[model samples]
Target chain A: MESTRPKWPWIVASALILVWTIFPILWIVMLSFKRPGEVGNQKGFLPKHWTWDNYRTVFRTDLFTAALVNSIGISMIATFAGVVFATLVAYAIARLEFPGKKLILSFALAIAMFPVVSLVGPLFDLWRDLGLYDTWPGLIIPYISFALPLAIWTLSAFFREIPWEMEQAAQVDGATSWQAFRKVIVPLAAPGVFTAAILTFFFCWNDFVFGISLTSSDRARPVPAALAFFTGASQFEQPTTAICAAAVVVTVPVVVIVLAFQRRIVAGLTSGAVKG
Target chain B: MAAITMKNIVKRYGDGFPAVNDVSLDVRDGEFMILVGPSGCGKSTLLRMIVGLEDITSGEMLIGERIVNRIAPRERNLSMVFQNYALYPHLTVYENIAFPLRLAKRPDEEVRRRVTETAGLLELTEHLDRKPSNLSGGQRQRVAMGRAIVRQADAFLFDEPLSNLDAKLRGQMRTEISRLQRRLGVTTVYVTHDQTEAMTLGDRVAVLRKGVLQQVGSPRELYEQPVNLFVAGFIGSPSMNFLPASVDGTSLSTPLGRFEMPGEQAAAAVGDRGVVLVGVRPEHFEDASLVSEDKRARGSIVQVPVDVTEWLGNELYAYVPYEAPADLAAQLRELSRELDSDQLRTQAVVSLDASSLIAEGTEAALWIDTSRIHLFDPATGENLTRDEDHAARLTRAAEPSRAAQRSTQQPTEP
Candidate 1:
C-alpha cells in the first residue's frame, strides 16, 4: 500500500537539480577530450573525435605545474597556522573571564562579515611596498587572516558545548591542568578541530580575488590565477582544452577531502561533544 | 588518612557579596562529615574551598599537618564525585576508572588490577567495556564512585552526588556511599541540601544558613537541641513549629494553653527579650487520651480543630491550623522566605499513635511535653536554650564511630 503511488514530483525535481548541477562539469570534461579542430564545434555537445592531447598539453606547461605546487604549499600552511591560532583564541573566548570578551567576539564577527574585495586594493599596494609581491608569504598572509574568523567562530561554538565539570573532575582525579587538557579536553575537541581545518583549507584553496590581485608570476600564483594566463604550444593553437583539464585537476583534492571526512563533518556540525 | 581543617575561610565574588563567610571547621581523621543547608547557603562553596577548586579570599586550610591554602587541587591528593557524574564519554568504564592511575604513571599491571578490583567492588564487572552513555543512571554513578575509590587519596569529596538520581536510586546510593566510606575509613566530606541525607549519613552534621555556620553536632544533638530558630527549622523533616509567645511573671501565653515556666527556665526565657519564640518538634506531641497521669503532670494540653489527619498504620500526623497576629505571621513569612520553604502556614503538626481516634475537621485534645520546649530571642534569633558545650562533646563522641569503622574495614592490597 505504501508503494502504490508514483512519486513523480520528487523524481522530476531531483532530475532537474542533477541536470542543473552536473551539466557544467560534463561540458568541461567533454571540452577537455575534444580534438583541437573541434574547438567551439557546433555539430553537437559530444566530441566527434577524442584525444589525450589536452592532458598532455597541460602537463607540458611549467606555469601550470609551478602554480599547482604553490597552491598546495600555501593552502596547507595557511590551514595549519589558522587552525592553531583559532584554537587558542577560541579556548580563551569560551572558557576564560576577562574584561572585554563580548568586544572580542564582536570584532571577530565584524572581520568575518567584511568585504574581501575592498581590502585587495590596499593589500596590493602594501605587499609591493614591503617587497612581498608575487611571493608565497604574500598570498599566505591574507589567507590566514581571512580564514581565521571562520575557524574561530566554528571552534569556539564547539568548545563552549563541552561539559566544563570534566576538567575539575580530572584535576580531582589527580591530573595537572596541562595533563587534563591534553588527555581529556583534546580528544573531545578533535572532531571540531578537524572540521575547522577542512573549512579553512577550502577557504584558502577556493580564493581567486586575492590570488590574482597579490601575485603576478608562476613563482607564487595559485591555479585560479595562473589559469587565466595559459598559452598554447604554438601560435595558432587555442588553450581552451588545456585550461579545462587543469580546472578538473585542481578540483580532485577537494572532492577527496570532503569524501574522506564526510561522516565526521556531518556529526561535528549536528551534534557537539556534549550529551544530555 | 588525614583530617581537614579550615580556619576562617571566606569566599567573595566580584559583587562584594560573601558566598561563604568566615567559616571554621575541623573534620577529624577517618570521619564522615556532612554539610547540609538550603540553596545559596554556601555549603557547596565551602566544599569547593576544601578541595582547592575555589580560591579562599583570606584564611588558612590544612590537610593533616600541611598548610595547603595555595595548593592545586591535584596536589591536595583528593578525589571528588561531581553531581553530574562527569564521566568521560569517550572512554569505557574501565578506562574511566583507570584514568587517574594512568595520569600518575602507574604500571600497566597495577592499573589493570586496581581497575578490576574497583569494578568488582562496585558490582560493575559486566560493564567494564561499555561507555558511560550506554549505562543506566545508577551504573554511571557507580562508575563515578569507582573512579574516586581507585585513587585511594587523602580524602573523598562529594558534591550532592545523589541529587541527579531518582528517589529509589538516591536511597540506594546513599546507603552504598555510607557503607563504602565506612569500609574504606577515608576522611570524607559530603555536601547536600537534603536534610534526610544529613540525618542518616553523617557521623556528624554541620548546618549552614546564608554563608554562616549555625550548628555542628551529632544528628541527635541537632535534632534534640538546635542552636537557633534557623537550625531548628532547617534540621527536622516536618520542621519544628514556631509560634509567638509572651511571658508574664511566671506563665507563658501562646496559641497552646498557658504553661507555668519553671524558675530557671523562666529566667532564661525572660532574659533581655520580653517576647520569645516557642519551638515544638512534631514528635513531641501526643494524643491527650494516650498520656499517663504522671506524664500528663509534666505536659500541657491544648484543644485545637484538626485541619487534616494522615494515618500511616503505625503513626498518625494531625495538622492543626491556628491564628497568628499580623506582625507574627509576617515574621514567620520572612523566616520562610529566608529558608526557602514551600509553605508558611500557621499550623502545628502533632504525631500521635495510630490507635488514636483523631479525625479531620474535629476538635482533638493534644498534649505536648512542656519540658522539651525551646525558647529563642525573637530579635537576635539566638536559642537561649542552647547548650554551650555541645560542639566539644560531639568531637569526643565521634571517636567511637571512627574506631568502629576502622575495625570493620576490609584490608586492601598494598
Candidate 2:
C-alpha cells in the first residue's frame, strides 16, 4: 500500500528525521542508565552493569522528591482540566452556530502563535506581586495557558467529524444536550482527547526554559528545574549520573503513557496528514 | 409509534441561503416515509430538521402532536442512523448496541436481551464481539441498524444509510432495510438521492428540489399524477419522457406524437398562454398491436426510431428517436445530448413485457395510455392534471379535515 521512493532528497529527509528525532532520544535514554562517575566521561551506545545506585541517589534528594511530585501533579491536573474544558469548547465551536466563533478561533491560533517563553518574566513578576510565587497553582496556571490552545484545536477537529445526527439521536433518546456531550461526543472524541492529553503532558513536562525562570524554590520546582540544578560552571561538578537518573525517571513515565496510547495518538494526529 | 408533522419548516444557514425552505409533510404513524431529491436538494437537511439535528429557522416541528422545535434530539425521543454508520469504531457490536441503554443506566440483563433480539433480527448475532472496523460493509451497516433498533425510539431516521455499499449490496441492503422497517413498524424517515429506494421503501414519497417540496404521495399517485415537471421527471427510474407541446382544441400538438389532452389538463392549456409540456411514462408506451381495437380505447399512437437497446433478462427497455416541435426542437437541439441522454439516448425507453422485444434502429408505432398522460404549464411548471379549480380545495388545512377526507376514500390494500 506504500510506495518506495528512491529519490536522494526524500531519502535524506527521512534519515534526518531518524537522526534528529529518534537518535537523540535513544542516546538520552542510554545515558540515563550510566554510572554517576562514568556518565559524560565518554559516550557509548550501551551501559555496562546499568547500576541503579544513581537512581537511589536521585530518590534521596529533596529536590528530586519534590520536583517529581510537582511535575506529575501539575501535568496530570493540567491535562485533565485542559481536556475537559477543551472538549466543551470544541463541541460548541464545531457543531453549534454561534457568533464570534471565527474571532475566538483566531484568538486561539494567536495564543498558540505567541512565544510562550516571552511571557515568563511578566508571569514571574505577576505571580510574586500577587503573592502566588513558589506555589503549585503558580506553575499549573502557566502550564495550562500554554497547553490549552492546542488541546482545543485537536479536540475540535475530532469533534467536527462526529455527525450532528448522533447528538440528535441522543437528544431524541431522552438525553439533554449536556448529556449528549458527555455520552456521545466525549466517547467519540476520545482519540483526540488522548492525543491532546499526551501532547499537554509532554509540553508541560519537557518545558525547561519557562520552568527555570518561573520558580526558584524546592517547593515549586519540577524535574526540569531539578535537572538544571546540577549545571554549574564553577567546578562544583554536577553528578552526571544523578542528573541522568532524574531524567530517566522524568522521561520513562511519559514514554510509557505514549507507548500505551501510540496507536490512537498517531491516528488522530495523522488523520488528515500527508504521508511521505 | 408516533406520527411526525412539520408546519412550514425552514432552515437557514448562517451564510443566509436557506438550506431548507418552508417544506412540510405528514409522516404517518408506523409508516416508512422517505425524503428524496438530487444532491444539495435539502432532503438530508429536512430529515435532520425532524430529528432536531438542525434547528428550524422558522415554522414548527411536531412529533406526534408535540412541538419539538425547541427540544433537543435526545429529549425528543427519536433515534437516527447516520450515513457513515457512526458506530463507535472502538466498541464491539454488543457494546455499540448497548451504548444508549447503558447511558440511561438500564440493567445489564435487559440490555443483553434487547441486544440479542436486535442482533438476531439484523443477523449480526454471530459477530457481537467484533468491532466495527473488523466487520464487513454489510455487517457494519447492520450494526448501525442494530444500534438504532435497540433504542426503541418513536421514530428511526436514516440518512442515506446504504449509499456506501456497491450496486449489488445496495439492492440487497435496500430490501433488508425495508423489511426490517416493516417488521419493526416504528415510524421511519429515510433520506436518499436514489429514487429506487424512495419508491420502494416509502409509504409516501416526498420529492424535494432546491429546498422546495414538489409533492408527497403514494408511489402510484406520484407516478401517475405528479404535481409539476420536477416531480414528473424525478419520481421514476429512467424518468418520464417530457416534450414541448401546445393546446389545439381537445388535443395537444407535439412533434413526437399528438396526444388527447384530458379535460382537467385541457382547461389548464386553454386561451392566453397556450404553450405547455407533455409527459408520458416509458412503460406506458405499448406496441400499437398490443392496444385494444377501439380508437379512443386504444389511445394515440406515435412512430419512433428505436435508437438503442438494453436487455435485462426478463425486462427490456428501448431507447428511440423522438421528434420535437419547432420551439421544442430548438430547445431539444441545444439539450439534444441531454434529451437523448447518455443514459437513454439514441432511444426513448419502452419497457418490454417479457415478450417479443423491439429491435434497435427500427421504426415502430408506439401507443400511449392516454389516461396516464401528464401536462405541465411551460411558463409556471405546474402539473395541469391537478385540476386548477380544485388546487387549493384539494389540500387540507388541519388534521381532522384531512382525516375526514381520508376516511371517505377506500382503504388501499397493503
Candidate 3:
C-alpha cells in the first residue's frame, strides 16, 4: 500500500515544510549580517552591504556579555539540579510501590500543565518579599520547578523501561544496593539523564516570561529578556541588527546541544539489559 | 562451597498471603537442587528468599553455618543468574564479568585473571570488548554466566536461566550448565518450571504447588515413587494417566476395564477407601501383541477403542478415550489445570513400540504393568501405595555415583 503511492507528492510536502521552518532562521541570519543603518531600509533578503559590525557591537556591549554569562550559568545550574532530583524521584516512582505514588505523579502532571504566565505575578511578588528578586536564585528556582515535572516524567518512563532484573543480578553478584544502582541502573539510565538535562536546559535557556518580569538588571537577566533592553548608538536609532546578532548567538548553543546529544537522546540504551 | 539450609521458612506479602508457606529444605554442599512447579507456585520466590532479595516472614535461613536471614544479597556471597540473563547493557563483556571483583575492590591483576578464566570457561573470550547490546542472545547468556561464575561466590543460584533461549540452544546450554556445575562442585539451587531441566540438571528436585512443598528427593525417587497425585502428574512430559478405579478385593474396576492383580500388589494398593485414582505412566502400557510372551503373562491386558494416535518416528502414542464419573472428572480437570495441562476429556495416552499397527478409531489391546501402577486416595490426593523404604533406597543408590563424579573432577579445579 505504501509503495503504491506516488513519491513526488510526499517529497514536495516535506520540502515545503522544511523551507517554511528554515526561512525565519535564514531571515534572522541575513538580518544579523546587515549594517545597523540598513536594517530599516527594507532592502532585498540579502544584505546590500554585509558587515561584521553588528556582531562586533553585540560582543562589545557589557550588558550582552554579562547576560550571556548569566544565561549559561543559570540554565546549567537549573538543568543539573533538576536532572539530579528527577533521576532519584523517577527511580523511586518507577521501581518502588508506596502510598500516594499515583497522587504524586498526577500532581507533577498538574504542575507541568499549569500556565507559566499565571504564576509570574505571584512569583514576582513572592521573590521581592523574600529578597530573591533580580538575582540568579530568583530565575533558577522557577526554572528548576518548571523543568522538574517534565524531567521526572521523561526519566521515569526511561526508568520503567529498564528491567528490575539488571539490578537484582548486580546485587546477587556481590554489589551493595548503592553500588548496583550506580553501576547498573545509572548507566542504563544515562541516555534518559542526558535527554532530561538537554530538555531542562532548553526550557531555562529559552524562557522569556519569568526572565523579563522577575529580573530588573544585567545581574540575572537572561539573553532572551536582555535582548529587549538593547539600545542603539543614539536615542532615535533602534538596535534591530544587534538584537538579531544576539539572537543568532543564543540559538547556537541550543542547536549544538541537540546535534551533539541527539543520538544519546534517541537511542534506547536498555536494549540488551534483558532478554526480549 | 556452602550448604544453604532453610528451616520452616515462610514468606507472606503485605496482603498477608503466604507465597512460600512453611517450607524446609536443605541443599547440601556440592549438590544441585532444582525447585520446579508451574507459574505462581513460589519457586522463584523461594530462590529470591535464599539470595536475601526477599525477606522471610518467619523461620531461619542459613548459608553454610551463618544465619543469613538478616543479611543483604551482596553480603550473603551468592551469585544468581536471572531468567532474563540480565547483562549490563553499557558494560563490555570483560567489564561485566569483572563487576563483582571490582565491587569487592580486588586488585586489577586478580580481576583480569579471574575474568579471563571465567570468560574462557563460558566461551565468551572473543566477545570481551563488545558491549552486551552487540552480542547475540546466546552470547549475552554466556556473559551473564561469566559474571556469575567469575565471582567464585559461596553458591550459584539460577532462576530459569535457559528459559529465554530457543529450544535447540536451551538443550545445548543445559548440558553446558550441568558440566559447569559439576566442574565447580558448588552448592547450586536452580529454579525452573521445565521438568526436563529439573530432571536433567539436578541431583535432587523439590516440587512445589501453591507455595507448598510437595516432595524433595532424588529425581529417580520422584519419578518412580511420587508421594501424591500432583508430583506424579507434574514430573513428566506426556504426564501420567489418571484412571478412576474402585477396589474390590484383588480386582480393580477402572473406566478402561477390570484388571486382576496379584494379591500382594492389590493389598498394598487397597486402602480403607473404595474409590481411588490409579496412575499409570504412558510407557508402562505397551501394545499387547508386541509384548514378549513372559511379560504379557505377568501383566493384564485391556481392550479399548483408540481415539487418536501420534507416531513420532521413534515411538507411537495411542489415545484411548473413556467416560469418567462426573465427580472424578472434575477432580482430574482441577489437577490437570494445576499441572499446567488442559485435558478437557478423560483419555489414556498409551506409549507403544513404533512397529505397532494401532490406528485411530480402532480397537486395540494394551498390556498394563499392574505391579507398577500407583493408587491414590481420591479425597486427599495422597498416594496410597507410596513405598517410603523403596523411595529411600532409590535416593541412597544415587549418592555414590554423584560422589564419584565429584571426586574425579575435584583435582581439575583450583
Q: In terms of lDDT, which candidate is strongest? A: 3
| Per-residue lDDT of candidate 1, residues A173-234 (tens digit) | 88888788778877788888899999999998989999899998888999988889887767
For model 3, the docking class works out as medium
Chain A TM-score vs. truth, each candidate: 0.92, 0.86, 0.94
Per-residue alpha-carbon lDDT of candidate 2 for residues A112-139, written as tens digits (9 for 90 to 100): 9998778888988998999778887888
lDDT of 3: 0.90
DockQ of each: 0.67, 0.30, 0.67
- Candidate 3 residue-wise lDDT, A43-83, digit = tens: 58999989988889889998899999999999999999999
* Chain B TM, per prediction: 0.95, 0.85, 0.98
- Candidate 1 chain A — worst ten consecutive residues by lDDT sum? A267-276
Worst 10 residues of 3 chain A by lDDT: A267-276
Q: What C-alpha lDDT does candidate 2 achieve relative to the native structure?
A: 0.77
Off by over 4 Å in 2: A1-56, A231-241, A272-276, B15-18, B257-273, B288-297, B313-316, B322-347, B352-359, B369-371, B385-414
Better model by DockQ: candidate 2 vs candidate 3: 3
**Cα displacement (Å) at residue B155, model 1:** 1.0
| Candidate 1 off by > 4 Å | A1-19, A33-53, A232-237, B260-267, B388-398, B411-414
- Could you arrange the candidates by DockQ from highest to lowest? 3, 1, 2
